[model samples]
Target: MHIVAVGLNYRKAPVDIREKFTFSDESLPVALQQLKRTKSILECVILSTCNRTEIYAVVDQQQVCGHYIRSFLANWFQIEIGEFADYLTIYEDNEAIRHLFSVTAGLDSMVIGETQILGQVRNAFLLAQKHNATGTLFNMLFKQAITMAKKAHSETSIGENPVSVSYAAVELGKKIYGNFKNKNVMIIGAGKMSELTLKHLHANGVGKIVVANRTLQKAKELAGQFAGTFCSMGQLEEMLVEQDIDIVISSTGADGYVLTLEQMEPVMKKRKSKPLFMIDIAVPRDLDPRLMDMPNVYLYDIDDLEGIVESNLEQRKREAMKVDKLIEHELEMFHQWYRLLGVGPVIGALQEKANRIHQETMSNMLQKLPDLTEREIKVIRKLSKSMLTQMLHDPIMRIKELSAGRRGVEELDLIRELFALEDMLKEQARLPKDFLLESKPSESDDDRISPVNPVLA
Candidate 1:
């Protein structure tokens, strides 16, 4: 058996092409059923997110399975094969395993080191499991991937800092005050930037948001979204003093300063030295730069937030190296387990072949020794079984050890040829009963394990 991953991701496909292949939550089960119904695909999982849509499957033939998967995708999504074929990527075996590990570790995310992809990966596996689309191989692989992802997050600082400007502002707020649950937030504008910043703050449990804008209607509209209070820009000072707002996010479209040093110095004094955090996301700067020098007041402008974001991104990149090494370690461990799977069918076939020969010889001996007692016959049978096991022990152990390395399939084939167990091995090598019925590859196709390359036209 071989593992294969065929799909297009953010790196290879544009949003339009990626969206075309994306599977909806309601359609995922049906899609999985359709893929597994194909002759080549044995087991499968579909991972669809805003950035990528991937299909990971265990297949009987890697060489032709890519064609089968591509055909399935084109037919299912009702797209022309020529239209999106160039965007597809195919990975088999080790490459497939590494791709999955990287995805679960968040290394494949649009934003590196983001933790959301880890949960997304887990959800995809669970969805596949729910539909009975996965078996022993995928079950173990996905579980190990998730465990490795958790280890990456806990052991390294990949998800420690924020890499986006909006999130950086929130991170800065977190540094000043550990939690936002009790703090009041004051927004100086009702633009998209302010709304986005407010959204992050709200997510972090900020309380009692006050929206102040030149247009009272827009302020009220934005404030209504968060169930917070609204006010006109004229009452900004009163709201600053009376509302006890701890964080001020200003993004007004005014050339002049909205909150000058002269205006905030008195408000700072009235608040009895309470610490204030301000984020100014305006081009000309809404909050006066001089306000940063004021006692108990911390201010960050657009450039400042961008600097923090850049620095955090660098830190995440550094942490990603640690995650990469962790993935390599986990991949080796998973490969060891996967290699052992090949040994089982081969060993089973060998045992079956030997038992047949032993039974044939014993039947002929029993005919010759008709006077032998039934108890003596039983003793002879037990001795024959014990000798067979002892004789095969060393060879079986060597086959298992060799199977864990690169020449596993070659060695197994040699063993089958040597024991004249070709037919027996073929029966044992058939896809498991639980798997969907599929056409087996011909003898000539057995050695054709190479994957189809994406048409980069």
Candidate 2:
């Protein structure tokens, strides 16, 4: 069996292409079940967020796993493979494992060392397990990934300096309006990113915060967290016209532009050319692009924050070197676990054959000497058992050592041939179920960390 990951991220695909492949919260379980049922796919998990969508799976066929995953995406998302095939990236075996570890460790995020991706990874793994989409392989792999991420964050200061798209947006606003104490901020979303932006603004001492959402209650709740006021989506245009809203931060799930050029033209006109600085962090972009062309209107989308993100990354990059070391350690542990799956049954079968031969030989001898005392017979049995154990101990130890190296499977095959254990080995087939039953609980379980709410990017 092989571990494989196929997907696109912010580095490989733009937000427009990335948004097309996203699996909504309501659609994730169904998509997972469907993918699990696909040919060659044994176990699966889907991780979808604003920036990326990744599918991790254990498959019987290494060469064709990517094709199957792409096919699954096409069927699930109802788009042709050509539409996204070029954007998709595939990794197998060790590369797949390393990618997952790096992603969880925050080394692969657009904002390096961001803590939110850790929680996102944990949520995806848990949801997959809950819906029975994961088996032995994924349960171990994902738990290890989560444990590694926690270690990376705790041991290093990668996430120490709070830098995110939201934080960057606030900084950009400060450039236009130096003193936020008198600047009125309007955040047009109730999601986590919007709340985070509001938090940054609150820290900067912004005045008159208003959160607008499709649902007034959610808007009210988010606004209440920052001691700000709320308004409904219907009231958004009215508030833009009536209030002296200096800066606007918009992040929403709308399919199209929430603030269109036609809608904003009149609002901008009413302001009589008062400069309105806007930041749109949504994937489908809540604010219209044409709004940027208007006089005295400055609009920045998610991609615009990259420059700000880059400038503040030197210190985090230094810390990320520490995270890379942690990933290497975790990767070795995963490899060792994988090796055990290959050799465990071989060792069991070898020992079983040795014990069988010892028992049969003793049974025939005892029958030939029927007059022997019960005590003598017991002594003979005990001595012969000890001799059999002693004879096999060295070979067993050697087998374990060989299994940890590069040519493990080849060396194991030779051992199986010598013992005439081909039939027994064939019956095992290296399926995840057999190993799960034979294996001990992973060390990660004892050290598993709770999911954390991200304070930074």
Candidate 3:
């Protein structure tokens, strides 16, 4: 199988395009079923989120699969190939496998250690599994990928940091205040990050939420979703003073700081020095960085939250080395399985050899012993079949174990060379019932990272 991952992500596509590809919970099933209808695709899974829209497929002919899938995306999003290709990225074979592993491990996520993507991956795989759109290759690949992601989280300190700049701000709040269950949150700015962080704060159990944007209508629209208060920038300071916000997450698109230390200094004095967690995720930084040094004022600029994001990213990178080793081990195991995938052909040749010999012997004996009773002939046939099974049992068992991946591919390859399987197939005219039992066993695109590429059909 030629495993391929083709899609666009937050890194490659803007929010509008990304949102265009986002799979709503209501529509994933239909899209997944549609993906399977394309030719060359033996199995498929679609993972769509706000940040990415990726398809994982096992195909017979890669060029065919790639074309159909790309065209499908163009049609679905109503964009030309040239127009859309600018935002798309593709990975074939082992690069595809590595990408899947990295994604599940949180290395490729927008948030380095956020636990959400893992759930999304699981949900996508499960959706495919439900439709029987997944085969052995994908089932094994996805299952193992999930396990590796968990290992990355459990075995490292990568999950110790925030995943997004907005989330980093919330994390800074949690670090200082422990829980957000009873705290009020006023999400400043109407940008998408601000919207997403507002959702995160709600999900994290913030008691009350307030949306304050430059446009009161946008704020009102967003406030409707979270059931929060809405206000305009004209009323910014007044709203800030009136609401008693415990946390401020700002992503306002402004040329300069929206909240200065002088403005906030009096606000703090008006209220009795209540600790405030102010996170400015705006590019120009909505809050003054100098305000961080003030008492009862915990302010973080975009650079500071992003600094945490970078350090956390480095930590995730360090932890990913361990996941890499795990994938390495699994890759070796898969190679062995691939070698063993040839077991069906081996056993077929062997069984045919035995049966042919048995048939010839019986034919000649039956002509010679014309007076032989029917019972006697039947007994001879039964005896010959018993001998065949007993003679082949041990070797067949060993070859099968090798095929099932218990034996390494190199060792299995040695067995194939020893048995001269290519020559055997040429010599044998007919194969038995078990000839292709596993039907393309080593057909996994996710092979080990090695000096050699998988011997593709």
Candidate 4:
């Protein structure tokens, strides 16, 4: 099967168009199942975030697969085909496969070397699995992709910076507070972004954390896991007063400001102007934009983060040169395995022709010399099969070696030409008069490696 990717991402589509395609946490399983149900698909994953929406699927027919996926996506988002189609992009075969590996390695991310994408990809794969929307092809593809990501992180400096928007909030916290060891941080939402930000904080040994959300159950559930305090929205103002919260990272999905300048005035007063660092890491921001004008208050909206994140991006680009070789080497290894898969049918045809010749001669001899040499005839047949196997051994081994290096796909077509394999099966009709073709070739059941993922383990 061929690898195919179709979707619009941050580079090509504006926020409005992207938001329309964003899949909430609840929609992934259904989306995965829907994609897998399309024609020629063997596996599927849907990655939808505020910045981008992409689908990775393994399919057989590119013509049908591309249109089916595009149509499915357009229908799901309730967009007219002609209107939205222009915003979508599709990459097929090698281009699609390479893009996936590159993306997992942070090569194609908006933030040049973001590490969060690996986790995002893993989540998509898990969701696909949950819905039984995957098979062997995807199991191998994703495993390799994850492995590639790990290698990129360990061997390269790409993941050295937190390129994701969630972690950008942590960077902002660090800049404002200098040290989080003495800070009481309050996270306003219990979403994935909030959880990731908490992880970064926990690693840095933040003083304490508190979860204040609209739902007490969610607040308690999330807070308990992070060893933090929790309170419902009714107790938000009181919680803010009690914690002496040094930094506020708010990102709830509220329609308007969750907190206004006037609302935080009294809370700030109680702290004696402790320089509250507030980060509105949300769209339709969780706080009033005017809150920044308050004395001793450092409020950084998302725009302020771009500068810090950009510096981090610059550092990643400098270190990327070091990791470049590692990625190239890994891609070469994967390429080799893919090329080796093309030899299967050619080898099968060779063995089929040899076995048929042996069978026909055996039947003729057995009939012609019925009693003269029954034992001798059996010995000759065994010798003939053994000789044929030995003759074919060199070509098979060479085919494998040629398929094992960089850009091995280039060698597959050449191998097919050199061996005259396109016509090998046609020669089957030239069998001797007494020859009887076997019901099934002896090697027909041998293991085959498909080029998409020749091997994973």
Regions of model 4 farther than 4 Å from truth: 63-66, 81-89, 110-114, 130-132, 161-164, 173-186, 195-210, 214-218, 221-229, 234-248, 251-304, 401-457
Best by lDDT: 2
Score residue 343 of candidate 2 by CA lDDT: 69
Better of 1 and 4 by lDDT: 1
Error in Å for residue 245 of model 3 = 7.3
Model 1: residue 65 alpha-carbon error in angstroms = 3.5
Per-residue lDDT over 1-457 for candidate 4, one digit per residue giving the tens place of the 0 to 100 score: 6888889876677645665676767767777777788878888888775556898888888778878887888788788777767888789866776777877777777667777778888888887877888776677667788887887788777777577777788887887768788899999988777888888888888988998888888888888888999987767667777888888898776656788888888878887777788887765467777888999888877555655777778888877765566666665666555565565555556556556566777668778878867577657766766676677677666665666655456776686677666677556446663454544534522212112112331
Best by TM-score: 2
Could you tell which candidate, 1 or 4, scores higher by TM-score? 4
lDDT of 3 by residue, 68-154 (tens): 889878877677888778888898977888888888877777667666688879989999999988987889889988887887778
**Global fold similarity of model 2 (TM-score):** 0.89
All candidates: TM-score? 0.64, 0.89, 0.62, 0.72
Computed on alpha carbons, the lDDT of every model, listed in order, comes to: 0.81, 0.84, 0.74, 0.74
Over 42-61, each residue of candidate 1 has an lDDT whose tens digit, in order, gives 88999886567899999998
Pairs that clash in candidate 1: none
* Ranking 1 against 2 by lDDT, winner: 2
RMSD of 4: 7.0
Tens-place lDDT digits, model 2, residues 106-224 = 88887788888999999999999999999989999999999999988898999878887688788788877786998899999898889889999999999899999999999999999
What C-alpha root-mean-square deviation, in Å, does candidate 3 show against the real structure? 11.0
User: Which regions in candidate 2 have their CA more than 4 angstroms from the true location?
Assistant: 427-457
Per-model RMSD to reference? 13.0, 7.5, 11.0, 7.0
